[model samples]
Target: MRARALVPGVPALLPSYASLDDPVAPLRAACLSAVGELGPRVRVVASGPSGRRVGAALAEAVGAVVVDADETGTLVVGNGSATRTEKAPGHLDERAAGFDAALRASFDHIDLALADELWADVTCLVGLPPLADGDVRYDDAPYGVQYWVAVWG
Candidate 1:
């Protein structure tokens, strides 16, 4: 079995929350492109209902199906710290950058407590396979929030 993608649970990705200017245009495009790579049937792993909704919307946009059982591809929705800078959602935590860096290196042995403190949505990332250099499709801190879109086979 192979995991298809790792996308952020940013509400802006959804059409319902879209703005007139579309602040996350590039990120949204990258996510749709990555999600489109997964074959029709996909399993979604998300942190909560909102995350699941984002995954479902993406799947719907790409003509993919979200399956509950027996799936070859999995779509995991989550993100790094929301406090990368002063304008970040969690508002500037000095430790946010370093915390996100460690997560980017390896999802193994994460300090859950610290993750919560930093406002990282890593609930679904805990069990994912280690990320490799070439697997990353996007890695940037837009809106002062660390977001990544990666694929793993």
Candidate 2:
């Protein structure tokens, strides 16, 4: 099934790991930004001017190995599986007790601006990896808003 078909309805809280304070990037790099392997449920983050470059960077990052990443887009590389919940921290912390702690840990210090439904957090790609699940790759230029991603270890 198309990963987007399995979009989760529960409200999610992990905002992009990137921030506006990011150094200005060149246009060509932004045009080819990689969206990475979000697995089954790819939340297409609409990265603005730097969309292409960010996506390309993310795609390369996805191709590389990632660890302790419970938020941002969970890339399912190689043969691995993870359990995810509506709460982001719970998914990361080995000892997360409930939703509140999870939320605090996940969104702590992260800047959040209200985006349309298009900006909702992505969830539950499970065993799918970008190498195998390329659906998360958006070949086109970003609509404008690129995502800031962070891997909380």
Candidate 3:
């Protein structure tokens, strides 16, 4: 399976929800660039309908099509935590940084309880193929949210 990309489920990534001056312009650019590499037919894996919409918007931005079957590549949408700082979406949680750090190291074993408390959206990440150091295209905690955009062939 050619897994093309991994993006965060950030609502701001969607054009419909975009602001006059995008707060995540750089992040959006990165996401589009990554999605463009996924070829024409892409399969989207997300936690819910909202996430699916974000994925679809991203695919559209890159002139890619979201497919349910016979996809050329897979796009997994998820993120680490929303409670990394005081101004974070979920506000600061003492355990947020550690949880996100562990996820960055490896998405294999996760603490469900901690994830919930930290407002992490990692359900779609579990059991996914491992990402190599070189495969990581974007890795940061911008806006106190841990987001990654990695690709694998």
TM-score of each: 0.95, 0.20, 0.94
Worst 10 residues of 2 by lDDT: 5-14
**39-128, model 2: which lDDT tens digit per residue?**
322333322323323333444443533233333443221101112233332233332223223322343322222211223232222222
lDDT of 3 at 51: 87
Quantify how close model 1 is to the true structure by its C-alpha RMSD in Å.
1.2
- Which regions of candidate 3 are displaced past 4 Å? none
Model 3 pairs whose backbones collide: none
Task: Estimate the TM-score for candidate 3.
Answer: 0.94
- Regions more than 4 Å wrong, model 1: none
lDDT of 1 by residue, 111-151 (tens): 99999999999988996776774378889998988999988
Error of 1 at 126 (Å): 1.2
RMSD of each: 1.2, 15.3, 1.3
**Winner on lDDT (1 vs 3):** 1
**Cα lDDT of model 3 by residue, 1-153, tens digit:** 565688999999887888999988888878888888889998999999988999999998888899999998888899899898898989999888888888888889989888988888899999766666427878888888889888776
Highest lDDT among the candidates is held by which one? 1
Q: Rank the candidates by TM-score, best first.
A: 1, 3, 2
